[model samples]
Target: MVELAICSSNFTDQLALLSFKSSINFDPNNVLSNWTQETDFCGWVGVLCSRRRQRVTGLILRSMGLQGTISSHVGNLSFLRVLDLRNNSFHGHLTNEIGRLLRLRLLVLAENNLTGTIPPSFGNATSLKIIALARNYICGRIPTELAQLPKLQIISLSDNYLTGPIPSGLFNILSLSYLLLDANQLNGQLQAFPNNSLQFLDLRFNELSGPIPLLVATNFLISHNKFTEIPLALCNVSSIKILDLSHNSLSGVIPQCLGNFSNVLSVLDLRMNDFHGSIPTSFVEGNKLRSIDLNGNQLEGKVPRSLATCRHLEVLDFGNNNINDTFPYWLETLPELQVLVFQSNKFHGPMGSSKTQLPFPKLRILDLSHNEFSGFLPTTYFKHFKAMTIINETVGLRYMGESYYHDSVTIMIKGLEIELPGILTIFTTIDLSHNKFSGEIPNVIGKLYALRLLNLSHNNLVGNIPSSLGNLCSLESLDLSSNQLSGKIPSQLTSLTFLAVLNFSENHLEGHIPRGNQFETFDNSSYNGNLALCGFPLSKECEDNKTQLHPTPMLHKEDDPTFACGFCWKVVQIGYGCGMVLGLVMGYIMFLIGKPKWFVRIAEGEQQKKGKRSHKGGNRNGGRRK
Candidate 1:
């Protein structure tokens, strides 16, 4: 019984020592409640012991959200092979005494708030194979002594503020498969390293600039930097499956040789760059290509026709370019196509044929705004577009009559005005303002229950404002300004509680303005250009309503049709016509005053020839006289 007491005392001391080594606060929850001196350490939470329970073999407390400083007493666990406290909030520097763990194989303290330099003594852990300290506040240069670990396979120090060049000896670890040093202040060109056996390598979002070195990693991500062009060395890595070089200053044409890696290449993102010229046709030829993003560039010409063949393609973003062509008909054939963004391009024509099925049936988001697309969009386009933010505003339209225009027109996007389709339902809408669309406002627009944003400003639309628009409960923005709309302001429009922006200015609207709600909040500028509109904001009241027998000018439709045809129109026409004639006359006068440089040179040449002739004549006459 005396020997048993001694053994228990020794075990308690060992347990105390183990607790001091790790930087962890006691779990308030009962997760580690069993950890006590009375209980065997083997039965403790996150503690593993050997078969005899004489030594702790492993301490795995990953993702336990453990906080507090790591205790140096962790080294007391002499037989510990693995210590994983990853994905925790543990702060403070890693204890330098961790080197005492002679049998340690894996040490991962990633995704923590641990600050301060990595302990140099970590290099002494010769048995260590994997060390991941990524996503931390650890600063200072990577220790060169870490290269001494002969069996190191993975080292991730990404998303940290570690500065200075990467240690050269680190490349000597031929067994290294994954190295992530991105999102750091590390600067310098990538030097040569062992190309074989590497699977994942990311050096992106760093100050490091220069041509990418020849690497054989299967997954390569080097985006959001100052790269000037495509790294030629990257093309040689035929085994590369995922390559991302996005959001950089890379310019020039996209290299066509990328298609050579058709077997392994799956995802390639080169978005948000200065990459100009046309997309190479070879990219579409790759049979295994799944995703390609070339958005936010100056790429011109038509999209490659071969892209349709890439059956597995999911996301294709070609927005914000000078691409001038019709929508790729073959895109509808892609089975897995999900996101197709062609916004701010030069694409024109309707979405699809009236009889044919909707293109991209499974498409979730389709942004085709700021284009030259015209005509009444087929109802089928909105049938499958249950969840989409289609922006067909007419701000980019440069031509007239190309857009859909009928006798009764309603709804406007941008500046181009267009007629709303009869079968259109739900929240979708058409913006066709600023175009040549004419005729009276259509009453059919009230049937669309889902119409949210209706803009018909800056057009030639005529007739009275439709009161039926008040039925749209989901209407948010209603713009009908710069048109020929007349009649009293619809009082029912006050029911639009969701209406945020309402513009009806520059129209021929008259009569007492509606009161309360959005109207009261809006300034007089919204109801401007309507000379007959009288209310609290404009004036006191109409003259006829002020007194019992007050004589007021009869508001005759014939005498004052609310149309201003005064000297302003004649003066504008005369000014425009005279301005054109004056421009021509001034151009001719400037041409007369200015002499061509070539003509001046010819006159100077002639004068020089005459002088030479006189000199020759004088010399010849003197010789003859002699």
Candidate 2:
């Protein structure tokens, strides 16, 4: 009887496992193909049966492209301890029957298409330790029953549609270490809670308002919130590193003591805020700072020279601010500095540089547009971008530091918000537009063969478009418009086959526009404002001297209105000239003929008639006298 009971229990487990496989409508990899009854239930894939009694204990189906709703029979696996379906295409609400799994501990459904809210029956899983449903479509307020899990250590539901204030009970979880609820509809002011062993907390991209709580955490990001002030208590957290409070309504002077974590802080991003006054200059030596982004803020005054002490600094962006300092050539000393953006500020003076300093060797992205910067293009500075002059696919700079702020940063440059999608170093670019840069686009820029974008528009640059620019085989977008550049469009530009966006508009370019390759794909807009430029897209045709051969005089189509008007004007002019010549010829011929006989006879008769009339009048007078 005991053996029969055991067999019955094992059969029931197998049936439940089979039901779970049946629910999977699509399994591209055939990961569940071997889960049939023909095979022993213990040999099934992703099924870890217990040794003593044949029963499923864990089910990990991550990244297998599995589809369809999770089976309700999954709850029948009463001995299940772990259920991981992360990074899959699983949809539908979690079965409420999952509450029957009393031994469940870790539940990870992250990066899936699962919908519906957290099953309230989840409260029955008292032994749960971790619950992660991030990057899903789950909605509804977080079930307060989660607070019952005293052993829970991590709960992440970020990138979901969850709304309402976070449960206050979650803040009091003594064993909780990480809590992520970002990128959701979660609103309401955060409430203060007593400290626990929590370390990492991210609540950004939400509508959370009010003051920040005096919490102790290692990595904290609350940006895109409505906090009006930085709590002084944050400085007290000695273990803090990577504090991002950007895109908030927080006003007032930044606390000087905020730099107290120089020893631990690696990234301090306070961009897109209302913080005014000079930036705190309390950075000391031995600082481990890697990035400092204060763009789109109202901060004034100069960049603190003390920042030069951070040898490990990689990205320093202070664009779109009220900063009134000259070019900080002193920053060239930082060995790892890669991205330097200072666009749309009050920065003035010649593009200065250290006389004997080494160029920013690793620098790939350099943007200094829309400033009071004057003087010639800094060719020497550009030549030193060793990282951008070459192409290397092995380097992972394309993927590095992109999501350090969770999303693209927006700066109000040119009175419009511009989003820096990612700080990808491999996508090299140079933007010096909207400045007073003059002279010429230096030939050295062509040496940046790996450059993808170059913007020199709205400057005072003069001279012919450099033919050497053809050497940039990888150049994609070139903007040289609104400049004083004159001369023929270089034919060598036809070599840029990868060029997608070309702008020579608003320049003094003359002669036939380049044809063939990528140049042929450009339209009139690319050549607009250049009255001297003529091509297929323009109404004006190139002069015969500019083309290889003169165009033949072809008859215009009758449907062409311009041709019709031109033809009519020519006919009228020719008719008028012919009529004047004919009239003069007829008059000269009549004068040479002495006078027609009829005209002479008529004149003689008129004189004779007048004589007769005079005689008749005299005769009548004599008769009256008699």
TM-score of each: 0.65, 0.82
lDDT of 1 by residue, 108-139 (tens): 98777788998889999888888889767788
Expressed as tens digits, the lDDT of each residue in 365-436 for candidate 2 is 788888988888888887788877665544433323423342233332222344543443446678888888
Q: State residue 555's C-alpha deviation in candidate 2, in Å.
A: 43
RMSD of 2: 29.5
* CA-lDDT, candidates in order: 0.62, 0.73
As a TM-score, model 2 comes out at 0.82
Candidate 1: worst-modelled 10 consecutive residues by lDDT: 400-409
TM-score of 1: 0.65
lDDT leader: 2
